[model samples]
Target: MRNTVLDMTRLATMDAEHANRLLHQVRAAILAGRRPPVAPRPVIDASWQRMLRLGFDPDGRTSSELLQPDELEHRRRATVIGEVMRTLSGGLTEIADASLQIMVVTDPQGRVLWREGNAGVMRRANGICLEEGAAWTEDTTGTNAIGTALAARRPVQVHSAEHFVHTLHNWTCAAAPVHDPRDGRLLGIVDVSGPASSFHPATLALVNSVARLAEAELRERHRRTVERLRSVAAPILCRLTGRALAVDPHGWTAAVTGMAPVDRLPLPKTFGAGRVWLPSLGMCTVEPLPGGWLVSPEESGPPEAANRVVLDLSRPRRWTVAVSGAAGSWTQELSPRHAELLYVLAKYPQGRSAAELAADVFGDPTRTVTVRAEMSRVRRYLAGVLAHRPYRFSEEVRVEVLRPSHPSDLLPHSSAPAVVGERQMPGQDVSAERRRS
Candidate 1:
C-alpha cells in the first residue's frame, strides 16, 4: 500500500494533468462511498480524512476572515517572527516577483503577519482573502502549505487539487515552519505561493533553507541581547551576596555569584522588584537592575513531601508547569526553553546529565554549559522537588504531564530533535491521555 502511494506521487509529479484527473476521480469515489482506481499520496489522503472528520465539504466555499487593523498590529508586535521577515522576504523577493508568487509569513496560529512579493499576485491574493491578518489554519482554510507544514511540524508543498477547498485548487504553495532557537518554539511559517503552474519541487527546499536562516538570525539576536545584559550585570554582580543571579527581562541569566550560571530564571508574567517566593530559589528579593533583575536568596526552607508537578502542553499556544507542595501551589507560564527542559525531565524520571539534556534539547552534547545554565534556573523554583548531580525530580513527588490529545499537537511549537523523535514514537493513541503518577 505504501509503495502504491509512492508510485502515485511519482505519477502526479511527472504529469500535473493526470494528478488533477486522479484527484477528481478520488473525490467522486469518496462521494460515492467507493475507492478510486489509484490512491492519492498518503499526506493528501490523511488531509482528506482530517477534512472529513471536521465536517468540511470539499466543494464548500470557505471565506478567509481578516483580522482588524488594531488586532493585526498587536499580532505583529507580539511575534518575534517579525524580526526575520525582512531577511526571508529579501531573499525570496526576486524569485517570487519574477515568478508572480507571493511570500507570506504567519504566526503559529496561522494568522498572516506579513505578505509581500509580486504586486499582481498580491492583488489576486486579496480576492481569496489571503492578505495580511487572514487566518489559514487547516481547520479554517483546508489543507494548504502554511497550515499543513505546521500540523506536520515539517516543510510541505501543496499543489492544486491537493487543497481541500475547491476555490484553492488553482494555487500551489511551499512552506516551512520557523522555530525560536532559544527553545524550539514555532514562531511562524514562511510560505511561497502562486499558481499551480509555478509549482516546483525545489521550492520546498528553498523555503526550508530560508526558515533555517530565519532561526539562525533569531538565535544570533538573542545571543547579542544576552551579551549586552551580561556586560551590564558584571559590575552589579560584583556587589551582590549569597546565591544571587542577574537575569534579563525574559529570565536569561547574565551573571551569577555563589552559584553556577543558569540559562534562564522563571520570572512571573508581570515582573518587578519585590520579595517573591521563587520555585527553585526559595524566598528571594528581586531588585531591578540595568538590563535585568537581580535575585538574592534569603532562605532555604524545609523540604516538602508528596509534591506534585504538572507540565501542561495541550494547548496550541500557551504552555505551563504547575507545582504544588507544602510551600503551596504556584503555576508559571513556561517559555519555550523551560517547557522543553521540563518535558525532557518528565520523560526521564531517573535524571539526565547536562550533556544528555543538551543533546535532547539542542541536538548538541557539547552544549553542557547551556544545559547546565538552563537547569540551574529550573532548579530555582523546583529546588525542593528537584535534585542535581544528575538532574531529576525528587522520588517523593508525583509528576503528571498533560499532553495534547493528538501526538501531532504534543508541543506543536517545538521542533527540538528529541521532541520530534518522541512525536514519532509508535503505539500512542491519537486520543489517549495518560496521567503518570
Candidate 2:
C-alpha cells in the first residue's frame, strides 16, 4: 500500500541461511507446479503465476539480445521520456555508483533505452543482456523488476532467485513506473539494478522519489507550453465576444471572453474551420488559431433527459458511448483519455469531485484542473444527465457499460492509473448499471 518495494526489502534483511532456505522452498514449489511457499510474498507469487502463464521456463537461460545502435537511437529520439532523463540521471548517478548498481530507463514496453553508472557492474550486466535496447518485459525475461513494476504499475524490487530465469538469479532490481503528467499514460520506468549482494531496501524509495520528480518536471514543462499558448491567445481573445474561448490543441483553454472559464473542450484530432456540434455549447463555429482553436457558441435548447447512456468498450481501438433520447440516439467515439474518464465515472454513480477524478485518472489528487477540463467535454454530450458540484450522472437516466469478453481488452490503449487498476480486476463479462430514479 505504501507503493514501495517493501516486500523485497524484507527479503533482503533476512539472515542468509533463512533467506536461502525460503528461496529453495519457493523454487521447489514452483518447479513442482505448486503454489509458492508462504515465505515468498504475495507479489512474488503473483509474478511467478504470470510468468508461468506466459510460458516461461524457470530453468532456461535469459536472452542477451540488444537492439542495433541505429534502432536504439531512433527510439530515444522519439520518446518524450528523454526530456526528463537528465533530471532522473542526475539524481541517480551518484547513488547508483556508490552502490555498484546501474540505473536503467525503459520505455513502457520494457525496452531498455538507457543505462548508466558502475563501470564494473556495467560490463557484468552485459553478460546477462541487461543493456540498452534489450527488452526486459515480464513476458520476455520473467519476473524482473522493470517488467514487473510496469505490470504492477508501482515500485517493486526483485531479488536473487525471485527472478524466474535461472541466469538472472544472481541479480536484484528496483523499479517504478513513470507516467506522462498530462494524461497519466505510462512513459517508461526508472530502475536500479545490480548483483544481489548490493541490494538495499532504500533503493525502492529512492527510485520512487526520482520517478515522482521526473513526472513533476514533465508537468512543469507542460505548464510552460500552455502558458506560451495563452500569450498567443490573449490578443486574439480581446477581439472576440459572446461566450467565445481560445483553446490549445489538447483543449486547454488559453483565454475566454464573456463566459466563465472552462478547463478544456473536446476537439477532434483534425479540427479545422467548420460548424461542429459541441456538448455544452451546442453547434459552434470552429476556426483555426495561431496556437490552438477559437470556438464561438451557437444557440440550442437545453438537453432532454428522456435518454439512455450506453458505454461500449468491447472493440479493439474504438470506444464509444451512445446517448438516446426523444431527440434521437447518437454515439460518440472516445479517445483513450476520454474513454478512461467515462469508465471511472460510470463505475462510481455516487459521483466524484475534480480531485477524486484526478486521483483516479492521473494517480495524483492535485490535478483537478486537468480533470475539470476533461469533465467539461463529457458534460457537453451528456448535458442533462451529468451534474456537477461533485460530478455524477442524473439519477433519472439509466446507464450501462458494455465491456469486452476479456476484461483486458477494455480500453486497450489506456495506461491511466484507474484503467490499469480496473483491467486487473477479476471478471470476464464486466458491466456497470445505474437505474433511473
Candidate 3:
C-alpha cells in the first residue's frame, strides 16, 4: 500500500474542492460499511479500524479537555524540547507562515506544548480546539497527522476528508515524532497544520526532516553534557579503591578505573547514593558525581533474586526488559537487536543455541558468530538471570512476553524470522493484563 491514502500528488494537480469531494465520498462509504472508492492507506485503515472498535462518533464535537494554564506552563518548562523550541520555530515557522499553515509541537502524550505560524490559521485552529494544551491523540481526536504519527511512530500526512472526524475533514496536517537521541525515547511530535488547500505531500518530508534536526541538536547537547561528566569523573576515579565506573543518569559510562570499560552500566531507575545490588554487578556502593554517578562494585557473590523477567515488545518504538527479585527490580530499555533476541528467547524458554538463535534472528545459521557477540553483550548486564551455555534465561527465572495489543505491532520494526512470524499471528495480544500496548 502507498504511504499516503489520498495521493496528494494527484490531489495537488486536481481542483482542491473536487479532490476534497472525492475523498469525502470515500470516507462516507467507509463509515457506511461499504468499500471505499479507493482503499485508505494501510496506516489510515488500521487507525479507522481502531476507531471503529473504540466506537468513536465521527460527527461528534472535536474538543478535548484543555490543560490548566499553570499545568501548560509547567510542561513547557519541564522538557528539553523547550530548549530547542527556537530551532523548531526557526526552521519551520517561516515556511509555515508562507504556506498559510501553523506549526505545532506536542508532548509525548499529544498535548499541544507550543504552536506558531500564520496568524489567521492559528485563529482557525483555535476554532477546532487545536489551541495550546488541547489533546490530539488518536482516541481523542480521530485520525490526524499528529495522532497517527504518534501511533505509527513515523511521519504521516493526513489530507482533507482523510480525517476520521467529520469536523477535521476541512483541515490538513503532516507530522513526525521526535525521539531523544541519547536513549531513543519519544520526546513528542512536530506538525504543520492548516486548511485543506494548504495540503502538500512534501509537508510530511519537511516535518520529518525538522524533527530529525531537533534530535540532532539534542544529541549534540547530550554529547557535551557527557563530556563534562567525564571531566568531573576523571580525577574522582583516580582515587577509587576498587573496580569503579562513572555513568550518567541514563547509564552511559563516562569513565572507569580498575576494570575494563563498558559503554554503559545499566543502573536501576531509582539509583542514588547508597548501597545497591545490580543485575550485572553483584553489590555496589554508589556516590553522586557532578552530573552522574560513581559506582564501586563489591567483591561478593551475585544475588539470585531475578526470579522473573518480562520482555515487553508491545510498544512500536520502545521495548524494555524488566527484572525483579528479592534484591529489587530494574528495567533496562532494550535496543532493537536485543529486543528481537529476547523475544525469541521468551518464546522458546527451553533454550536456543547460538546457531539456532542466529537462524531465528537473522535467518542465517552461519551468523552464529554475530549472535554470540550480541549474546555476550546481553549477558554482560543480564548475567544474573541469563545462562550462556545454550544462550537462554537461567532455568530459575520465569519469563513473560508482553506482545502488542495488535499483532502487527509486535516488534513492528523487526524483520527477524521469528518476529515476522509472530506479526502474522492472528489476533495476538500477549499482555499479562490484557492492556493496551
Candidate 4:
C-alpha cells in the first residue's frame, strides 16, 4: 500500500483559510527566528525497514562510541570546544540530546577550526548521515542542508526529495550560513536535521537563529580590540598636552579638559562610545569613563616646564593636584616633544618597538629611517634632563607593558631613545627625581 500523508487530491479539498494560516504562522516564525517542534509520522519506506533489520537506531547509541573523539587528543579538543559552545549557548542542553548532532566549523577549503554540539548527537548523525570534520561541500555531500545553504548564500530547508543522496531521502534538514561582519565573508554553516517524516515548518527559523547567535560572538571580539586601542592612547594624550582626557568603555569621550579635539564626528552619548583624539596635545579620549588618577602638568609655568600634577579622579568628576619632588620639578627642563614621548611611554609602559614609538610620538610608522634619526635626538635630550638618573630606555616593551601592582600605581619605563647627560646629580637627588614623577 502506498502511504503519502500529503495526498494532492485530499490536500486540494482541505480548508484554504486553515492552510493559509499555517503558512502565515510559519513565515512569522521564520522572521522572528523561533524553533518549531517536529511532527511524528509513520516511517513505512523500504529504507526504514532495511535500517530496522540492520539494527540502526539513532536514539539507542552507546555513550562511549558516540562520545569518542576520533583523534587521539579527543579530550583536549573536546574540552575547549564543548566549554565554549556551552557558554555561547547559555546552558543549552537540547543540542546535546542523543538525536541531535554536532556540526563542526570549517573553512571554505574544508579545514576544521572548531566543532559545535555534543558527541552523542555527532555519532548518531554520522551513523545515518555525515559525521564531524567530514568534507561537506555541495558537490561531495550532494545538496542537502549545510552545503546547499552555503552555496546559495542564504538559509534553506531541504526536505526529503531535495536531498541528492538516496540515503538522505529519509531525512529533512535546515541550514543557514554564518558570515563575518568585518568583510561579510562566509565563516561557517549551521544546520538542524532529523528524520524526513518528522519535518517541522519552523526548522528553517531555528537554523537561522543559531547562525545569528554565532555572529553576535564576533561583534564582542571587535569591541575588545577597540577598547585596547583607546586604553593605549588615553594616557599619552594627558602627558603630552598637559590635559585631562578620558575614553569610556563604550568608546565615548569623557572629556578633553586640556587638549583640543580633532576630526569631529557626530558623537552620540546614546549610541556607540565616542572617540576623541587631541592631536596638538597628543591626547586621545574614549565612554562610562573609569575613575582613576589623571596626571597633568602643573599650572605655575610654561606648558613644557610646568610641574607634574596628579588629579584624584576617585571622587568628583575632575580636580587637579600639584606634583612634588625633583623628578616632578624636572618637567620644566624637558622639551615638549620629550615630555610627550615620556608620557606615551609611561602610559603605554610596555616599551614600544622603534616603529610603534615613532608612530605614537612622531605620528609616523613608515618613516623607519627618519624615525631612527629622530630617536637619537630624543635620547640625547632625555640624557641631558635625567642623566645619571634611574630612568633608562628599553627596547623590549610588550603589549601588556606595565602589569598593575595595585589599583593606583603604574611601573613606568621607556625605550624610545638613549640619552647622555651634561650634569650628574648626587644619588640622593636622582632617587628624589625617580620618586617625584
Best by TM-score: 3
lDDT of each: 0.78, 0.79, 0.85, 0.41
Residue 180, model 2: lDDT of: 82
Clashes of 3: 0
Show where candidate 3 strays beyond 4 Å. Answer: 1-18, 302-305, 312-319, 334-341, 350-381, 384-396, 403-437
In model 2, residue pairs whose N, Cα or C atoms come closer than 3 Å (at least 3 residues apart or on different chains), thus clashing, are: 279-380, 280-380
Per-residue lDDT for 20-60 in model 3, tens only?
88788888888999977676766677678668867999998
TM-score, per-candidate, Cα-based: 0.77, 0.75, 0.85, 0.36
Between candidates 1 and 3, name the one with more favorable TM-score: 3
lDDT of each residue in 1-437, candidate 2, tens digit only: 22333265567679866775677667777768775545466567667766775678888877857889998998899898999999999989778988999999998789999999999999999988898999998878988999888766678888888888888878889999898866456789999999888877788899999999999999898888788888987887788656788887767787898878877665544467788655456567888887678888864655345458898887654578777666555566675677888888888889899999999988999999999988876776567768888888777778899887656556744667787777687875666566766
Candidate 4, residues 1-437, lDDT tens digits: the string is: 12323322332354644433433343233233463221112111212222333444323321112223455245335332232354334422355233354444444432233455656555556665355445555545554566555544567676554344445656666667666543344556656666654465665676577667767776566556546645765655655645554443322333445645422121222223333221112112333334322223244433222223322212111111222223222111222234444545444433556567566655666766664554454443232222112232332221112122221111111112321110111221111111222
Candidate 3: residue 127 lDDT (0-100): 90
Clashes of each: 9, 2, 0, 18
Query: Candidate 2 regions off by >4 Å?
Result: 1-6, 30-36, 64-66, 266-281, 302-427, 430-437
Residues 315-402 of candidate 1 have per-residue lDDT tens digits of 7567887887665566777766788898888888888998899999999999999888877767765667678779888877888888
Better of 1 and 2 by lDDT: 2
